[model samples]
Target: MPPPPPTHADPPVLVIRPDSARTLGLAGDLWAFRDLLWSLADRDLRLRYRQTALGVAWVLLQPVLGALIFTFVFGVVAGLPSDGVPYFLFTFASLAGWALFAGILTRASGSLVQNSPLIAKVWFPRAVLPASTLPAALIDFLIALLLLGGMMAWAEVAPGIAILTVPLWVLALAMLALGLGLIGSALMVSYRDVQHILPVGVQLLLYASPVAYSASNVPERFLALYYLNPLAPLLEGLRASLLGTPMPPTNTIVWGATVALGTFVLGAAVFRRLERRFADVI
Candidate 1:
């Protein structure tokens, strides 16, 4: 047999630059760095449960604890309607949906600051910091959903064919939360003040939302403004699909989705504009 010619490697390419390019190419940037995003997400998920005794159980515990507290406060103490479902299941279902949104927003909002050392030492899409939070939050959400499925079975609630549509609702909520998170992260990089107020704002928004209570509780006069919250229709639709609660009007979901998309564009703009100075300030 004759020996084959040796293969040669291609030369590496390198360059230096002074002024940075300004363009709205975040999607392309994120696509290019998809591996980095998955690595960061996997690292976060590991670190999250590394030393914990309960590990992934904490994901189930948090919403369970919250649901218990809410059931006591709203179901027993304050008297809230659950639309014929047990209060715990009702609140848990609602809370489960909200948790996904809240978790993503919280993580993404702080991603830049949390990864400050990496941002300083390395070069990647700054957008990836916020982008990576989605997968981790999604993992948490899926675990929580398993618990929710059990709760639904306990409550004798059955999800119908409509269950197929749940992802669309979740997508709308994710888009909205991510949009806010990106904007908050950009602002957080410049002004640490956002960190101080972001949790409080999230808490306020949680309570202001229909988590423990029913969306029907909102008066007709304020209904218009309530649906304007973007989360309103998404949460309502989620509850409807999962727990069989009354669905929000189709218009509400459509409007909220449109608003979410617009908000995402605005957030991306703000993120890109402020991204250049991240290493300097962060």
Candidate 2:
């Protein structure tokens, strides 16, 4: 045993340290862990529909059901105007945009807490957990979009040339959701109240925005304050693009873009500030 004492010193250890110079190097860190991001997203996507009978069909079904309800409650009963477009088409178009925001916001907001086991056990960019939620939500949005296409054809309503700008509206909505999600997920680690509060907030927001009606229905006195909501104009813009309604004013578009992007940056900052404590607290 004495003679068997190791002749070589202990093996070298690899030291890991964070870059303090920039704690929130989101872009670089995300790129570095891109594979892990996709892995988490794929796992979620599979688990989401694993036991479901309808599977992805639910994506189409959900919005159809929601559109039907909105069409009935607001269009039929409330007698809300949908500008020149049929109320169902108008509501469906806006729901498409709303679903994108709602899906991403809800999923990403709960991501950190939902993945607490992995988060506690592993060391990776925490942002990836929230970011991973986006892919699955985006896939759902795309699936629902096919249904929208067929509905559009059936209605014989052609989107105008402004339809080319759909991507811009989508981007704005996504940015806003991601920003809000980042903040919500971070807060959720410290306070469970956020999860409870968020759904109520989203419900209130749904009614506040032009989900079942046109922006034109908003009284002129409330126009300025309404557009300040950011979602109002973007959703309106998206609906207009797809249903050939009038586009939101240029000023509102600029304001919404600014708010969306600014919120994203702010959320990233807040997440980074709180990230160091996530494993300890959650």
Using lDDT, give the best candidate's number.
2
lDDT tens digits, residue span 1-282, model 1: 987654222124334455554332888778777888999999998899899999877877898999999999999999988888888888888888899999989999999998899988898789999999999888777877888898778768888777888888888888889999999999898889999899999999897778988889889999998888878888888888887778899899889889888888888888987887899998
lDDT of each: 0.85, 0.88
TM-score of 2: 0.92
Clashing pairs in 1: none
Error of 2 at 98 (Å): 0.6
What's the TM-score of every candidate structure? 0.91, 0.92
Q: What CA RMSD would you report for each candidate?
A: 4.0, 5.6
In the range 90-199, model 2's lDDT, one tens digit per residue, is 99889989989998898999999999998889888899999999898788777777788888899898888988988889999999999999999999999999999999
